[model samples]
Target chain A: MCHRSRKTSRIRPAAGAETSKTIAKERLKLMIEAEKQKLDDDTLNQIRHEIGSVITKYVDIEPENIEVRVTLKDYKKRA
Target chain B: MGKVITFTSGKGGVGKTTTTANVGAGLSLLDKKVVLVDTDIGLRNLDVIMGLENRILYNLVDVLTGKCRLKQALIRDRRYQNLWIIPSSCSKDTTPVLKEEQMKRLLGDLRKEFDYVLIDSPAGIDYGFSLATSDADLVAVVTTPQVAAIHDADCVLQILKKKKKDIRLIVNNFHRQMVKDGDMLDIPDICELLDAELLGVILEDENIIICQNHGEPVMGKHTVSEECYRNIAGRIAGQEIPIPDYIRRKSIFSRIFFKNTAGKLV
Candidate 1:
């Protein structure tokens, strides 16, 4: 017979704050989404520069001031 | 013909080599002729982990470059008569010595000779990885529950999917206590996140390290890790053994009612 310890097993976390596992899951989901997009810094920078240049031709915007962010829409619903 | 399977992890230190060794051993224990190939080139660990380091005279580079015959490069395991290993070259230079065509030809030759040819792929999604997965009939991507490891696994999975390879996921170093305490990611969540067929989950067992330190695989023993490996090997061998639920979080009612009984209620 296998003997188990008498320690109490807490399956649910205390009310209010999120558990570390939840946080890790959310972070991993976002990270994997970003990784799947395969958008490197160089590509993002190029996008930023190209966008900034196109905007400067029409409006007064600096290339350094242009920020390109990649976010996955509906990533939470992803299987 | 034998099936060529490559064990790879995009991130380093995720038990790719250990999994290759133990799974190869487990398959051999099932009376299948299995051969493990270390494809890490400059950073080979399968030889050391399988305890055939001292016997490795001709490595994979030698066999591919015509420096030695395939039989001469293969090192038969002392414990498992049907299991053999072809270690990688340990030269200081990290230049890739084996090309993709060469690796494919070598794997083709291996498939004709063995029932299962397991290749331990080096970490990263570089040339070495391409060479390892070039001719693989199946690819097993090993990863831990960490964010970085899972992210890298997803990256590798995307690449393998583009290549249209049959891919599976293996979760390693799973800490049940931490997962129970809501401190670590559970197996099901990981499987969903990676979006790959679950192969197996190896519990975080120190015996794995201890056995690898002794240049032996953690198989055939009655340890939890051994059972996990055997189940994985069974699945690989087309056995329908159900994967044991390592994270069966006990409900409050069951915890209250079966508290006094043996801890098998969960």
Candidate 2:
């Protein structure tokens, strides 16, 4: 697994707006590197509860009453 | 255009003929026009399974050989007006009957007239199977939960993918009692093991064999097996009908041993 800190450190801009385009391209490459998955309903429901409970413990929310929904990432290829 | 779907299994006696007959019948029951073609040439079974054996005046060979029109060759189902069967003949060797081109032409012509042209493919991944599935828009790979059947299904799935044919898995002969006893593989287990999208599952029902012996289409027969075929046909027609849960029944062993959950106060 790639840590967010490590990924950010490597893909950070070269200290100026001159390299903004390069950073954007680098980030696009990083985004494409993550795995895409098709999850079933049972797994998705379990994930919602586990993640919701952990987040509710950290934030101002009730774990039992929390609601969580997921959406697939939609994208189109460039010609 | 009518969709051409082939019901196939690399292993024989896995209910491919039965699935084709009932799924076609179920689709016709839903008012969709269907003509089932038995591509298992020499050992034709669909006509007999659907009980249209005596009605076959001209088989698929007659049409392909330019002896009859496609419409003239099809035997209309007695039970459903919308369903028909283009049966294969057992009177002669079927080895040279179907060339891939001829099969394509036949399906192309049939596609113009019906809502669905379902083919019962011959068992194995040989010449008969290749010709049968040549023009299929979708292939329903039928299989039982047995180890050998699933292994053969996996082989068929691999070959279908290699040809880039649209494929879906149909697990047949699922037994509720056997499944509950942990003696049978369930739908999810087979699908995962085969790594193919499941179209439907047929339970091991006595009604299917009863209907077959009586020369009747088993779908819409007020059994779980009937519902299974209907749901499969619905999905094939692009209706998203969820797979019906197997009707739960208490196992004989369970009923005998665990009849009383309440402990005795003695």
Candidate 3:
């Protein structure tokens, strides 16, 4: 027979050192950037150019203003 | 109000349209009312994927512009009674034609009527993508195992993360054979790279392409692909269903001898 002696249970923090959102974001950015760099520079440039053209046509922004920063896509900033 | 889930991809030919169509059909299988809106604008493929091109009376453009009512624009699915699709305009010059406020208003109205509004967003991280996913309750980034698709998906994820939007991932066209042979990027690789919650994975099934060509979604194929979509739909509807990621190839010997483990025949 088992006795019901579970009254001492309490909530506690999770195991391991928790990572902050900012650090996690930075780490993810680095990983993604590394993966993107695996592609040929020529192909990456062509894709960037294509994105610039679409933005110029639809958003009416100059090519210079249409920065294709691989850090974060502009839609998030705009939203 | 019903939830609006947007299916978007960073690159073209990444199966965004097909995923949206299948998810809509799967949701309908659960007796939930679902409307699939083709927001691809100029490069619309949802109509062709769903095989409802000839039935298109009006489109999202017409509904937004007041040329046609929202209900009039929706084409009821030929098979699923609870499913509908709002096709996109055939005009390729429909750039910058849709506005966010108008879309929000249209979706707001739609939310009151349906159980789910699934938007088939266009590829690329441009204006079209922004407008399509501006007001989405959930955004799913669909990607294949290829490096190009994965890189773009990462970029898309960063953007969504910056906006603090809830982001989910769907790994499509995943081939277990390739993954087992270490020839293709696996699911954990994708999840860790993007650092996003995974909604589901759709294994490589020729039936999906065949169904698209025939204008029928894979959800009705009753194959492993169908099971994938059904599980995804159940998850989308807030049900606690385990995603059946491991699918075994149909062979009597393998079935009789091998224990199926994560899409491998070992």
Q: Candidate 3, after superposition: displacement of residue B4 in Å?
A: 0.2
Segments in model 1 whose C-alpha atoms lie over 4 Å from true places? A1-79, B250-266
My TM-score estimates for the predictions, one after another, are 0.72, 0.70, 0.71
lDDT of each: 0.79, 0.76, 0.77
* CAPRI accuracy category, model 3: incorrect
Tens digits of lDDT, candidate 2, B1-266: 89999999999999999999999988898889999999877677887777676677788888888989987998888679798889986644445656888888988899999999999999999998898888898988999999999999999899999999988888899888888788888665776688777788787776666556556776645665777888788878777666655644356643332223111210
Q: Across residues B88-148, which tens digit of lDDT does each residue of candidate 1 receive?
A: 9766557666678888888889999999999999999999899999898889999999999
Instruction: Name the better of 1 and 3 by lDDT.
Output: 1
The reply for model 3, stretches above 4 Å from the true place, is A1-79, B245-266
State which candidate has the highest lDDT: 1
TM-score of chain B of each: 0.92, 0.90, 0.91
For A1-79, candidate 2 gives per-residue lDDT tens digits of 1111231122222344334344335543543442123353456788898999899778997787788887656634422
Please tell me how candidate 1 rates in CAPRI terms: incorrect
Off by over 4 Å in 2: A1-79, B247-266
CAPRI accuracy category, model 2? incorrect
The DockQ values of the predictions, listed in order, are: 0.01, 0.00, 0.01
Q: In model 1, what is the error at residue A37, expressed in angstroms?
A: 47
Tens-place lDDT per residue, model 3, B132-170, is 889999998999989999999999988988888888888
